[model samples]
Target chain A: MQTKIQELRKERKITQSELADAVNVTRQTIISLENGRYNASLILAHKIAQFFGVTIEDIFIFNEEEENL
Target chain B: MRGLFCGTTARNNEEYRKVVKRRMLTMTILIIVGIATAVTAYMAFHHSTSAISDHTLGIYSGVGFGMAASGLFFLIRDFLLLRNEAKLKQQRLEQTDERLAQIRDLALKPALFTMLFILFTSCLIGSIFYPVLIYILLITVWAFLIVYIIATRYYSRKM
Candidate 1:
């Protein structure tokens, strides 16, 4: 799973720490999400989406093929 | 400060404060118990009237001192968390972070298996020297399995 969190954050002029604080997570979690090293849980994804004022699909790009593998 | 990002709400702060208070209380109890145990052990050893051996009393003292030290360490940590809101919020975030939770869960199984393996190997080696050690280690292993089974059953029903 890939996320547009970095791009969205940059567009909104928000730092990773700010986004993480808004989402009630550590800054490391946001960093990991942007680096594609970690996949956010549904609750976290919802929180992030709400923080960004966008739908989950708008930020998270889920690849069916990659998921199948 | 009203809308500032503290990673916790009023309800969370209240709950965290309660948790810290509970932990502090437990630590205080542990410290009291530890000191009492250590003092009793010392008195028993010095009096030489108790049926318990000197070696056993020494072990009890050591365990008591260890418990007291650990209790003090955690008590201080909880005290700091209680005193500082920013540190409390950061600690809460670290504790509740999904990624860290996942990593901890992932690491738990391997760590438990490794510990069991080490204990089993030590038991095997110790069996050659002392028969009682084998029973102790075997009992410890059985206790672990029993606890694990109980926890699995509990979560299975709850979840």
Candidate 2:
């Protein structure tokens, strides 16, 4: 899973720690999400989306072939 | 390496450096103490004055050597880990993560089930051989369960 978390956070001038605090996750999780090494759980995805004022789909790019068909 | 310390600000990096320093100091102290105890025990065992003293020295040596061996293992582990500050930072990040707690609980389910199975089997076998052992096992299990419940409740509330 690829995420626009780094881009969105940078645009908002937010640090990784601040974003992690907002989403109740560790900075490592945010880093992992940005690096596409780890995918967020549904609840965490929802929280991150809400923090960035976006939909989950907007922040997380899921390849149709890889994720669905 | 990339997880905790990666991309940290200067302030956070300095804080982690202090933490790593403290950890290294503590581990070093433990290793030194363990070695001293082991050496003392070895000397006492070798220079016993009488039979009773020899038996006491033997027990002391066993305990001291066990502590020293475990301490050495931990010291080596800490040395390898702390040599790279980034790895320690990453470890700290993982420890603070809430997802790890949930994963730990999930992992414990299988371990708990296995422990219960073993305890049950042990109790059954003990009943056939020496019924006294069954009572001891029952008490031990009950105590362990109580402690586990208390710890779980405490951590859940605290976290």
Displacement of residue B74 (Cα, Å) in model 1 is 2.2
Candidate number achieving the greatest lDDT relative to the actual structure: 1
| DockQ versus reference, model 1 | 0.75
DockQ of each: 0.75, 0.26
lDDT per residue as tens, model 2, B1-159? 123222222234356566655656776777677667767766666665543376676776667677667666756765677677667655555554556545555677887789888888988887898888788778988898899999999999999
- DockQ, Cα level, model 2: 0.26
What is the iRMS for every candidate structure? 1.9, 5.6
lDDT by residue (tens digit), candidate 1, A3-60: 9999999999999999988888889999999999999999889989999899999999
Candidate 1 per-residue lDDT over residues B8-36, each given as its tens digit: 32336668787678778999999999998
> Could you tell me which residue pairs clash in candidate 1?
none
Q: What share of the true interface contacts does candidate 2 keep?
A: 0.38
True contacts kept of each: 0.94, 0.38
Any idea how many clashes model 2 has? 0
